[model samples]
Target: MTHSSVPAPSPDQESLFAAAAADYARYRPGVPEAAVRLLADVLRGRPDPVLLDLGTGTGQVPLALRHAVPGLAHIEAVDVSRQMLDRARDALAPVLGRCTLTLVHAAADEYRPPAPQPGEVVRQPDLITCCRSYHWMPGPAVLAMADRVAAPGAAVAIMGDGSLWSHDSEWTRALRELIQAYLGSERRAGTHATYTEPRRSYQEDLATSAFTDVSEYRYPVARTWTPAAVVGYLRSTSFAHPDLFQERHEAFEAEARQLLDTYTRDALQEEAVFTVLLARRPGTAS
Candidate 1:
């Protein structure tokens, strides 16, 4: 709530999200409450914990945690997309309580929080989070940055719940096929590229970093989406973003809504496993 340093994001074209930021702000789901409680539990024992969130699209994680974590001194939310950062700042400002919030417009690996203000207690981030965004970064460099700046024994938590595009359900399958018919067989990424599966797992990447010890947590997540919300969610995604559909986005959305209506009278459901990989230095305990 107090400070900012100004600059998605992909591994390229940070402005790719500029056009869709409004949709993203309106339609993108916040992290499940379970994730919030889990993190609150993680920091409950620390004297005063600070959190750094990388690739913080719309600042959902930080915004959710703003009032939950006890003695949480500060939050640094870093993202490459200016528009997403704008949405984040707006969303977080109203709810931010005792904790200091910093919105940084920069890449994860390149960002550093400001020096503590005069009369502010010294602080270093004790928890670093990358929610639904680790895959879009230079994993090694970002991990290295976390190692350099995070407090000793600090934890790095990486969170992801699979996208609707990958869910296995009648409506989702139909939607995928519909997207392929318009955009082609491969999933789109950013502006002019396709999404490629990661060659190595996140665990493997963490094992090689300074925060080498890792543990995983899974929370069952169920979401219901209205046809209109689905269309808005698609607009916020890189794969189904309006830009990817060329001139056909409006037509595609119309068809998608109709297709969704055929599947359900009101809502489409998705069951997902929200996975958190909590990493720490050797012998460190959360």
Candidate 2:
């Protein structure tokens, strides 16, 4: 089913995750291992390669890739939410000593590559990764910014599967309906943002951008979730964030638990096909 493009959350709307940062860190799934391997291959022979990760929520992508690519020299992780960045910092602590890490609190499109310091040489980033959160960015502008800052052979990987609320599974269907019943039938995102099905696909956006060479890799993975985990994950999402319920938060949870329990008894597994859309400049090797 076609849904609206997830709009970039405005200043006020960006506050949606402010209170849910902790839940976000604890519940959001890790980047697929296959995706990390693909990224590692891109930086394989490059010396002291730097990675620029946009919308680095909880720093999950970097955390997952640290062991996969021990030679990675640095990472610039940018996000607009201070709360999310805080949890990301904590989550990324293990790898801080292994690689230079810079956490920038700025919108994806507003952040620029860091300037070089005296006697210190800074090379363009070798790889860029945006997972799950690219929908929150201004697509064309961010792509343009990436093209301007990337190294000669650099590639951009935009990765995501639809959120649980939008998945087509039976349980997810009921969960989405429950949320709609509470927050109105329209899907809610960020604070005031509502999802509008995009007229153009992300592939189309990249095809017209400076990075016109693009390919997609899909990994079909089955995941199991408990009732509590499902509810916790919901709290981390923009559409079903707890604040939307306000005074009814506790009451809503009680009902949601009852609803989820019915499905978790025998099976709580769903097949989520994670897709990584890799885009590179015209002359870059894929």
Candidate 3:
């Protein structure tokens, strides 16, 4: 397709991850506990703190932090994809515990909590988090929106680790080469644009936002994946979505399985570093 003719990401993103929601829910790793603890540390004393998790794919972050935050009474898990929200709803329903969950279908900038009627209270989110999905959003705009709706001294935490496609290893290298042969050398981003690194870093973006004070924490994560899990994970990625493979998907899977077999007996190794940036408005308490 010509550059001018190429589609930009749609506002709703309703169909972006539609085809691979099942695999996404299954293969995407959960947010780590130490990250949750650091996020929770920011809201340690807030009574009945409300959490607003942005791009909350399958409700993983909020689910991980359900009881981590002090009296985390209500959670607003927002996503643009209907399929992911549905999966999140299903995954969170049973173990809600003391927290009430509200699944919102919205782009980050479009999300606003319910307006309080006369004599009612509209409690703003104490912590706003976007994990592994913030780059997909309009960063400045989303942070501006958060400034409008969040409580005084509220924190915004953005978290992510590089994906398997981005990791460097013999198996991942072979896998990337295989995908490049089928697709292209450039990375595919969520159905529309080719992958380009964000011009400004997250810290730089936050530096300009209302949340000026930023602290970054990195946690070491070691993982081993079965070849089947690797295949399933590939299906869920924007770079290697099943739609990109078309009729050759099964054939590719067979080749990927066969290729992974030579890399090791069964498991593929991953050593990743997950990072979280916890930010707040200037003068917000620690």
Candidate 4:
């Protein structure tokens, strides 16, 4: 299992994510109940502990975890996008007083602990978690940053890079045909048939690293969306060629509508399952 380096989001990609913020908030899948339960289990005895959520886009993971673990007090939600941070703030407004929502506008690579004044020392978090955003940073850099910001015995949990949908039984054949027909040979050869093993490779890299007590878990989740919702999701994609092929984009949407019509007549239901990886820093004694 070889983990490919996570690439930084391009300017265009950032624009797409920012533009699709509403859809992302509405249609973006939630963290699986199983994954949320695992996170709660990890933080079971720690009350009012400080937890940092990296790449906290629209604050989905933290919100989900907050629901699962009511005892959690402080969550520093960090993301590079101001628009994303704004949306997250709006979403978590009700609980903003109970929980400290610090929205940091900085890239993952350049993020740093707030500088200590005089003789003061910066405090590391008890737990640091990232969901669906770990793939946005290079693995080595993220690991190093995690090591620096997490206190001894703190946990670093990540869940995503699971977007490859070609593995699912229902869409595999159809997606393959669509890719072949729409994407030319140059791009077609680079695509993966499934996302499972590639995601596992990333987990294996973390598990084998010096980070102690590393573990992995897989959870399944499904969502039902109308064709309009599906189109919204597609619009959010970094690979979507909307500007390059305006006419083709319309055609592809029409084809997708037809496909959805054939499948469900009323609405399209897509099921996605993801693997979650949890790793903890060594205890102080170690």
Predicted model with the maximum TM-score: 2
Candidate 2 local lDDT, residue 6: 27
Estimate the lDDT of model 1: 0.84
RMSD of 4: 6.1
Clashing pairs in 3: none
Candidate 3 residue-wise lDDT, 170-269, digit = tens: 8999999999898889998766668888888998899999999888899999999888999999988889988888898899999999999897765689
lDDT of 4 by residue, 175-282 (tens): 445644775423221122111223435566576554657677876666676766666665554434344335687888788767656666544555677777778755
Candidate 2 per-residue lDDT over residues 163-205, each given as its tens digit: 7876788888988888888889888876677888766788988
TM-score result, candidate 1: 0.93
- Model 3 residue runs over 4 Å out of place are 1-12, 117-119
TM-score of each: 0.93, 0.94, 0.93, 0.79
User: What tens-digit string does per-residue lDDT give for candidate 1 at 123-162?
Assistant: 6788999998898888998899899898887999999997
Question: Candidate 4: global Cα-lDDT?
Answer: 0.64
- TM-score of decoy 3: 0.93
lDDT values, one for every candidate: 0.84, 0.82, 0.84, 0.64
| Stretches > 4 Å off in candidate 4 | 1-13, 116-123, 183-200, 241-244, 265-271, 283-286
